[model samples]
Target: MGMAVVTLKKGEGRLLKSGGMWIFDNEIDTVMGNFENGDIVLVHDFDGYPMGRGFINTNSKITVRLMTRDENVDINEELLEKRVRDAWEYRKKVVDTGCCRLIFAEADFLPGIVVDKFSDVLVVQSLALGIDRFKETIVKLLRKVLAEDGITIRGVYERSDVKVRKQEGMEMVKGFIGPEFPTLVQIEENGVKYEVDVKDGQKTGFFLDQKYNRLAIQKLCKNAKVLDCFTHTGSFALNAGIAGAASVTGVDASQLAVDQATANATLNGLSDNVKFICEDVFELLPELEEKGEKFDVVILDPPAFTKSRNSIKNAVKGYREINLRAMKLVKDGGFLATCSCSHFMDYELFTKTIGQAAKNVHKRLRQVEYRTQAPDHPILWAADESYYLKFYIFQVCNDR
Candidate 1:
């Protein structure tokens, strides 16, 4: 039998019409077939014009994740292999294939699946039951696709232990997808070496999205004293050290992260200049201010303050507080690099929050540059979720 059919309400699906990939459950008018959660289904409008084909799940708010608009396209091994190959080829042309986001879920047209390649290792996170069915196939296809380019993936690991799985009514799972080897993988990026812990580290063991942003801030650190707040695994501080900074202090609340960051500094032979401190940045920044401490460069790469829309107000407060304190800590005429990783804090809201902080502190923010995630994490227009990261560099000066 052919795939089941789905119909959307009138005036709904404006997002899909605008090139987005998701269909909200509220937009669905009726489901006209025996399709359970995670089953491939055909979608159509109220008038019965075909919209697309996608995976349907009653368990998730995103009822349908459209796979392709072409009705003739079949959902099979051939299509899966093509998606993997197309993603790889796009990455090779735009990003360094040695380390990058191989598949960015909806951005790469493979909804609910994320694959990151770190050297010879691939880490995958499949969210929905429908998408999870194809996780292994995607990995095998990816391996074969890379083999054509003379690259061999040493191992594949699954990082599906996140809570999003529960929303989809799936079990939390994390383990090796194939033959097990050392989970500790090493890779170099932006002239710095990192020992990525694929088994237990945060977000696929490393934040590949900030690859170039780290390199952009390094230019302001030559012979300077730098402070990197929320320095997960010490990427920013290590970059400052590699850029010839006289000294670097990286602070994180997680002791495990600080310990691993210290190890990373040693691995890169940068222990002499780069150091890690296990402390809450909020408390430490105030203490530094009380002691009249300042730095030539200050970086704030804090985690997403709010993961959901309800917490956006508090998230703005947090971002403003950190940015205000960080601006005060920068030496006169020096530099500050700051960013928010949450899409709930949209670009306009983020920039406005920063401006309010600058006003309250009575500082002049000379905008150096505004940047986003590297090309590997491509932001699809109209798909607001694809565009999350917002980065900025500024020179701080007293309002004379």
Candidate 2:
């Protein structure tokens, strides 16, 4: 007959009512019309009050991802173009567009898709089945939007290889979306250079969210000895070196990442002062402590300790252990920059974990500054998952 309608159970859709984008499968009461899993359907409350419109995926626990709050709106080319243009415009104003996240999924009102710009290349990640159908259209629109500003997109790549795709009943796949170009895309940020491997690198090649966070440590690193743990691709360590750190040692367990970080250091002409070491940070931290090694500044940019809530307890312990060891390695009055990239590790819990670490090591922390992800990764207030990066800089002081 007409478009399918989805009705939410009574007292459900609480997250959607509060400006969030997801409607869980359990929250839906009934389906009124036949539709495919990825079809756009009308959604209403238990009493038939129209809620909004979203694409439905029965296979996903997050059944509906609302595309709009307006009952009259249609999902079409015009709407997609507007979304693409709005995301690009916002990035041009708030962050360095040379290399940054152009669209942060639900945060940009385009749920289940993320697009990143690295110089002349664009990387697209489609996480939901509903959005996968429109992925190509969004990419074309984005290319056209950037072209209007005289920016030529030489290549477009799809990195939809994340495990979450399986949750949505889709295959994890990655390859060139159009004409094949070199997968190794070189770009610059904060006066440092990097080669991003879109075909293989983690999470769309690089972490653009830490852009300004890397810049934040420059002044403090000048002429100081620095340690960068979990230094993926050497973003922080290279930033320290470029800022004239006397010496910078970057550590990561991945040999590929270490090699990439080493190449990046050479690209920035900081090879002599900046070095990459392939070692497990946990084991190395305690070894450094035993050796009585100290640094003027220590940076801990670990990968997400917990991807799900089920593992949060262990994540807290991991965070506490690393922070405690890093604190012990920091000279008195030295700077310690730490962060948690997992949304499961919320701000309050992460802060408390770090506090516990400092106390366990008998060290006091003088708060210097607190920051979230760069504006390009805007934290939508009600969408807590969009606000993952929690960064804090502190002065670690030994008890007198």
Candidate 3:
């Protein structure tokens, strides 16, 4: 296929030059050029200097998500194989253990695509229109790279159940790409064992990024009563239980998550200490307060509230509301581990929102620790925005 030439308007080339992956629609001088969706476009400065080669989609607000900024790059099947192999090599070197986040979108120089490898199998998610068009190439490269390394790919599943897939004009696809389905695979994270459900569970079956954070909580849960809110799959609750928490209450809105959490607790032999409850967290927080129940350690990790810039205001309100009630439910001198996965909400703003929420509840707050995604999920130094996960470990001060 021939590549389309796309020259950016004045200053539009700066982002690409500085290693930014996305090119917004308004930044393009497209009056002189028109490219169909999924077309490979060679981007250039207005002065005719080449910027990069990337897939273009006029339908999306993100006009271009650069796959490669190299002027000589083609981004075809062979190149895709190299990218996949290179990503795997980096992960293998960095992660001595078998379990880690294998591919992080822009951080690995491949925009709009994320692939997570749990042992011999792989789970891939296409998040952008441009990447969706190249899904075949990605799959081929994954198979080739695995074969070349003498590793048998037990299965390759497509879990594009994320909302972003619909926005990209692609229906959610979930199925095994390879010949076989993988049974639940065991992976150890910071001494805790987890079974990942790549074909069925949320986000490639596990939140590998929170692997370390869960371990951090284990230290404080000795004989403690822990409340794990929005605990999908019971990672925190199970950790607390395994760490000798007197009791762990795990709450989630999704019945499936509750069931999964229960099963996970049983798998880890922590069902005796952990209890799973399926309920709306927004309502349950208040109900816990009404029941005069307080926790020694509280964990609140909700799904992203703000997907776009327009939803920032409402998202902030949601964050503050949850944090406020969460703080109240934590006994004085206890820890409150709050997290925001929303990329639109920066770390500073997220913490500030939680602080404001604590003040509203008349609780004295002391920042204990700052946390982020696991090491396998490396963030590109050039792309700070890709560092979307932010966590805060705070203590409810009693001195007032």
Candidate 2 residues 1-400, lDDT tens each? 7899999999999999999999999998999989999999999999999888989999999999999999789999999999999999999999999999999999999999999999999999999988889999999999899999999999999999999999999999999999999999999999999999999999899999999999999999999999999998999999999999999999999999999999999899999999999999999999999999999999999999899999999999999999999999999999999999999999999999999999899999999999999999999878889999999999999997
* Residue 114 alpha-carbon offset, candidate 2, angstroms: 0.2
Per-residue lDDT for 1-400 in model 3, tens only? Answer: 5567777888775666676787888888753456678777888777888777888877777778788878697777777777778888887777643667667888887788888777777788888877777776787777677677787767778888887676667677778775767657766666556677787888888887887888888888999999999999888888888899999999999998898888888878888889999999999999989999889999999999998889999999999999999998999999999999888998888988987998798899888899998777887765767788998888897645
- Candidate 3 weakest lDDT stretch, 10 residues: 30-39
Q: Which candidate is the best by lDDT?
A: 2
Q: List the residue pairs that clash in candidate 2.
A: none
Overall lDDT per candidate, in order of appearance? 0.94, 0.95, 0.82
How do all the candidates rank in terms of lDDT, highest first? 2, 1, 3
- Please give the RMSD of candidate 1 to the true structure: 0.7
Candidates ranked, most accurate by TM-score first: 2, 1, 3
lDDT of 1 by residue, 1-400 (tens): 6678999999999999999999999999999878889999999998999998999999889999999998678889999999999889999999877899999999989999999999999999999788898999999999999999999999999999899889888998999999998999999998899999999999799999999999998889999999999999999999999999999999999999999999999999999999999999999999999999999999999999999999999999999999999999999999999999998999999999999999999999999999999898999887888899999999999998
Candidate 3 whole-model C-alpha lDDT, 0 to 1 = 0.82
Separately for all candidates shown, the number of backbone clashes (residues 3 or more apart, or on different chains) is: 0, 0, 0
